[model samples]
Target: MVYDKVIEIIKEEFDVDEVNENTLLREDLGTDSIGLLELVMAIEEEFDIEIEDANLDDIKTVKDVVDSIEKIKG
Candidate 1:
């Protein structure tokens, strides 16, 4: 599942012990612009997909990332 895969990637990338749907990409995980770029690249490589930059602007939480991935995959 993209959600599970995305969460695992996020946890490892952010060095977080745990995360949930409500976890904020910026406030909760402390993701900066550069970190966000790295994360997007990582997810793209892991899933063999492309996450457009415009779409990224709408991503705020863990669930948002998963949903975006699902949309790209679909």
Candidate 2:
């Protein structure tokens, strides 16, 4: 459930259509720092959870976001 919604959020935020678990946000989607911050904000609002600033550095792919959301929601 989280993965699907996350994919939607990412697609909307990045305006990309080909997003998957292994898709790299930076190398593949060309997501910059500001774009990442915006993505995180959207994810937080969608899930109603807080993602720490420190953890943002570890997010490299779509799966990472899904994992973070699952961990936070758990």
Clashing pairs in 2: none
Highest lDDT against the true fold, candidate: 2
Which residue pairs clash in candidate 1?
A: none
Worst 10 residues of 1 by lDDT: 1-10
Q: Against the hidden true structure, what lDDT does model 2 obtain?
A: 0.96
Worst 10 residues of 2 by lDDT: 10-19
lDDT of 1 by residue, 1-74 (tens): 78888889998999998899889999999999889989999999999999999888898999998888888888
What alpha-carbon RMSD in Å does predicted model 2 have with respect to the real structure? 0.5
After superposing candidate 2, which stretches have Cα over 4 Å from the reference? none
RMSD of each: 0.7, 0.5
The residue-level lDDT of candidate 1 at 36 comes to 90
